[model samples]
Every structure is written in C-alpha cells, then in structure tokens.
Target: MCRLLGVVTHAPTRLADTLTDLIEPFTGLSREHCDGWGVAAWQPDGELAVSKDVLPAHASPAFAATLAGSVTDAALLHLRMASPGLPTEPRNTHPFSAGALAFAHNGYFAPVEAIDELIDPDLLAGADGDTDSERYFLRVLTRLHDEDPVDALALAAADIRERAQFASLNCLLLTQDALYAYSEENPDSEVSRRRGPDFFRLRYQARAGRVVVASSGIGAQDGDGWSLLPYRQVLEIRRSDLRVSTHLVRGALVGAGG
Candidate 1:
C-alpha cells in the first residue's frame, strides 16, 4: 500500500504554495507508509522532473528539498509501504518514469508472473525494479501506443481486473499535458480489510486555482469541496486551464464538471 497525492495548478507554482494546508498532513503519512518516497513534477513547457529516495518522506532531507518551493504546473507525490515480499530500494520506489510520463500506484497484485504475461517482451526487458506497480505502469504505456492516456490506463486496468487478482489498481499518471487519476480496488482483499474500507478510496478537490487529488489519508474532510472519484473510472485534469473530466473505463464521459 501507498499514499498518492497529485496537484495541477493553472499556472506554475511551488507545491508548498499550491498545497499550503495539506502538505504536512500528506507527508505525515510517511510514519506508517515508510518504505520510500518519490515525486514527479512538470512545468508548462512540458518538461518533466522526478526525484525519489529509499528513505521515508518524513525522515528524508531530499524529500523536503525537492518539495520546498520547486515551481511546477503539475506534480505527483507517493509514499510507499512495500508489499510483503518486495524490496525497499530506489528502483522499487514509486513514481516510476519512462520518457515524459510518470506513474505511481497504490496497490499490489498476486503471482507477478500472471500479470507479466500481459506486458510487451521488450518493455518488460527494460524493467529495473521487481514491483507489480512498475509493471502496471508499463502495461499502460504499452497500450499508449494506440490509445489515449485515459484509455490506455483504462485498458490496462481492465485487463488487470480480468487476468490477475489485485488489492487495488488505484494510481496517478502524470503527463506533460495533463494529470490522470484512476480508482479501482477489491474491498475484500486482505490489505483492504487490514487497513479499512476507505484505504483505497481516492478523493479530489478542485479549487479556484488548482485541482488536488489524493488518497483517503490526506486531511480532506467531507463537504470541503472534495469529491470521491468513482471506482472503475479515470479523471483527467488539463494543465492549461485545470479543466476536469470524469470518464468510465469503457469510453463514456460521465461528467466534465470542474
């Protein structure tokens, strides 16, 4: 399990400035989810930057330095809690990057070989980590060859749902153009039961200047302009204007409000 936090601002702004009140609460989650931490940020110019470490966010000076006033139009933060048999190393950290896209996942799937069958051989050959999350990201990237970002994620997620048993497929995908969030999970999974029902639930808030999406642990309260993203759905937040859209995995635009 892990904690995910993504932010998109109408104009480039430091994360500290964009998420003034929520930063502490979000990073504070590292006390428990202390395996490692990673961040991916992008500027309006379409340049993406990523930083991560094997240290817990609360204890890592690198995390503080990266988040302290760095300007960006969009950013995604991940606090990882490694699964039972996974290693806690830099390669296994969240926010894995390939080219211009960065991905962070908050779930785990069983019998890695089962899911490995879905990835492209060449793509799988380039993997530097032994995590199911990175493979999930690569699966989405493989689908990106023909489909759009949202669709690629949807297809990859749908495939995982059908072929492998997983606790949660909830993830944050950050691109040069937009920020994508997908929420899907098996409530009956052991991890879910151990954590609580809301463990896999994702929530987002669209403020006047920015849109913030995060896991349930963030300090967001109900009716505070925060809305829980529906399961089996993906939400897109345009970087240019912060326009938001919600879509079903099967290709229906449920809502475009935000």
Candidate 2:
C-alpha cells in the first residue's frame, strides 16, 4: 500500500503553501509505508519535473527540499510501501514519467508477466524497473496517444482485468492540463482483506479554485469539504478552469479520466 497526493489549481502555487500542511503530516505515514517517495510537478512551460528517492519520505532531506522548492499549479506526490519482492530503488519509485505524463499507483496485482505481455514493446523496452505499477503506466501511455486519458485508462483497466485480479488500482495520472484519478478494489482478494477496507479509500475536495484528490490519509484531514470518491469511479480536474467531472469506469475494470 502507498499514499498519493495531487493538486490542480487555477493559479500557480507553491507546494509549500498548497500542500505542506497536508503533506508534512502525511510523510509521518512513511513510518509504516517506508519504502520510497516520488513527486512530479508540471512546469509553467508544460514540461514535467520529477524528483524521487529510495529513502523514506519522513527521513529524506531530499524529499523535504524538493517539496519546499517546488511551485506549480499541478503536482502529484507518492509515498511507497513496496510489496514483497520489489526493491526500494529509484527506478521503482512512484510518479513514473513518460513524455509529459506522470503516474503513481497505490495497490498491488498479480501475474506481472501477463501484464507485461500486454504493454507496448517500445514502452516496455524502456522500463527502468520491474514494478507492476510501472508496467501499468506504460500500458496507459501507449493508449494515451490514440485515446483520451479517460478512455485510455479505461482500456488499460479492462486489459488488466482480463489478465489478472488486483486488490486495488487506485492511481493518479498527471498531464499538462489536468489531473486524473481513480479508486477500485476487489473486496474478496486476499491482498484487500489483509490491507483492510480503509487501505484503498480515496477522496477529493474542490474549493477556492483549487481541487485535490488523494488517498484517504491526506484527504481525510482536509476537513468538511472532502467527499469520498466511490469505488470504480474516475475523476477529472482541468487545470485551465479548475472544472471537475466524474465518470464510472465500465465493467469491473478500474480506470481514470481527465
């Protein structure tokens, strides 16, 4: 399991001011999910900037410096607690990037080999590490060139569902103009049962021209305005206007849109 935090706003904002309160406390969660941390921010000229460390967020001076130095209208942050067998290496870190897109996931699934077979060869060839999350992101990126982000995600979910079962597929996908997120879980899966119900909880708050969607820990503390995003649902927040939209991912697949 892991923690995810994302923000999209109408005005350029410093991460220190926009997310420090929420993220500072969230880092303490690394005490349990202490594998690694990664952050991705969209630059003013529409490029993606990423920083990652294999060290746990709470203890990493690099993590603290990156957060305080970053200023952007759109950003994605992840704290990873690696599943069994995966290493705590920079390549395995979250907020994986390809082109202008960045992705972070907060769950586990099986049959990684099967998932790899479904990814585009070109993308798979460039893979830096062997985490299922990175393979999943590559699969999504392949479809993104031909389909809208939402549709691409839905397709990726559908494909994964066909290949294997997943405990949860909660993820955040960041593009230059928007933030896309989703929450999905198979309640009967062994991983899900072990992690407990709240393990996959996701929520969002849209207020004061800023919108944020995150895993339970961060959103839960945002107070009165937060709303739980239903399981199997995808959320989109446009950075241009801070508009929000929601969609149900068809079938048992877990997908995202923006």
Candidate 3:
C-alpha cells in the first residue's frame, strides 16, 4: 500500500503552497508507510523532473528539499509502504517515469507475472525493478500506444482486474498535459479488510485555479471541499485550465469536477 498526492494548477505553484497545512500531515504518513518516497514535478520548459530516495519521507533531507523547491503546474508525490517481498531501493520507488509521463501506484497484484504476460516483451524488458507497481505502470504505458491516457489506464486496470489477484488498483498519473487518477479496490481483499473501506479511496478538491487529488489519509474529511472519486473510474484534470472530467472504465465520461 502507499499514499499518493497529485496537484494540477492553472499556473505554476510550489507544492508547499498548493498543499498548505496538509503537507506535513501527508508526509507524516511516512511514519507507517516508510519504505521510500518520490516526487515528480514538471519544469517550466515542460520536461518532467523526478527525484526519489529509499529513505522515508519524514527522514530524508532530500524529500523536504524537493517539496520546498519544486515549482510547477503539476506534480505527483508518493509515500511507499512496500509489499512484503519488494525491496526498499531507488529502482523500486514510486513515481516511476517514462519520457514525459510519471506514474505512482498504491496497490499490488499477485504473481506479478499475471500482468507481465500482457505487456509487450520489449517494454517488459525495460523494467528496472521487480515490483508489481512498476509493471503496472509499464502496462499502462504499453496501452498508451493505442489509447489516450484515460483509456489506456482503464484498459490496463481492467486487464489486471481480470487476470490477477489484486488488493487495489488506485493510482495517480502525471503528464505535462494533465493529471490522471484511477480508483478501484477489491472489496474483499486482505488489505482492504485490514485497512478498512476507506483505505483505497481517492478524493479531490478543486477550487479556483487549482485541483488536487489524493489518496484517503491526507486529513480530508467528507463534506469538506474534497469529493470522493468513485470506484473503477478515471478522473482527468487538464493542466491548461484545471478542467475536470470523470470517466468510467471502458465507459463514457459520467461527470465533471468543479
């Protein structure tokens, strides 16, 4: 399991400024989910800038520095609580990057091979770490060849749900163009039962000029500005205008945010 935080704003903004008082509480989640941490931010030139470490976010000097220094219209933050067998290392860290896209996952699937068999051999060959999450990212990337980010994720996620035993499929995808969030969890999975129903839930808050989507434990309460993202759905926030659109897996846009 992991914690994900993504921000998309109409204008470039520092992460601290965007997260405000919730920043520390969010990073404090590292106390329990302390395997590693990573941040992917967009540069003014539109290039994706990524920095990560094997250290816990609460303990890593670099983590604090990156949060304080990153100034972009979009970013993704992850605090990892590695699966039982995965290692704590840079290669296995969250926010894996490929070209201009960055991805972070908060769930795991069994036998990793289930998803591996579905990915292009050439693309699977490029995997740097032995993590279901990384493979999940590659799976989505593989689908990107034929679908837009939203559709690609829906396809990738559906394939996993059908072929693998998973606890959750929630994730955050950051691109120069928009921020994408997908939420889905096996209601009867061990992790879900252990972490409670809200464990894999995702929520977002969209106000003038900015939109933020995050995993459940960010001190967000119901009836607050945050709205729950429904299951098996993808939420897209275009960076150009912070326009929000929601889509069901393999379905049409069902609603809009803010």
Residues 1-258, candidate 3: write the lDDT tens digits: 899999988888888887786788898999999999999999788789999998999999998889789888999999999999888989999899999999999999997888787788898999999999999999899888878999888778888877789999999998878999999889999989988989898999898888989888878766689899998889999988889999875442332111
Q: Distance from true position, residue 242, model 3, in Å?
A: 0.4
Clashing pairs in 1: none
Q: What is the C-alpha lDDT of each candidate?
A: 0.87, 0.83, 0.88
Give, for candidate 1, the lowest lDDT window spanning 10 residues: 249-258
lDDT value, candidate 1, whole model: 0.87
User: Using alpha carbons, what is the TM-score of model 3?
Assistant: 0.95
Off by over 4 Å in 3: 251-258
Output the lDDT of residue 228, model 1: 87
Q: For model 2, give the 10-residue run with minimal summed lDDT.
A: 249-258
Indicate the TM-score of model 1. 0.94
Q: What is the TM-score of each candidate against the true structure?
A: 0.94, 0.93, 0.95
Q: Which candidate is the best by TM-score?
A: 3
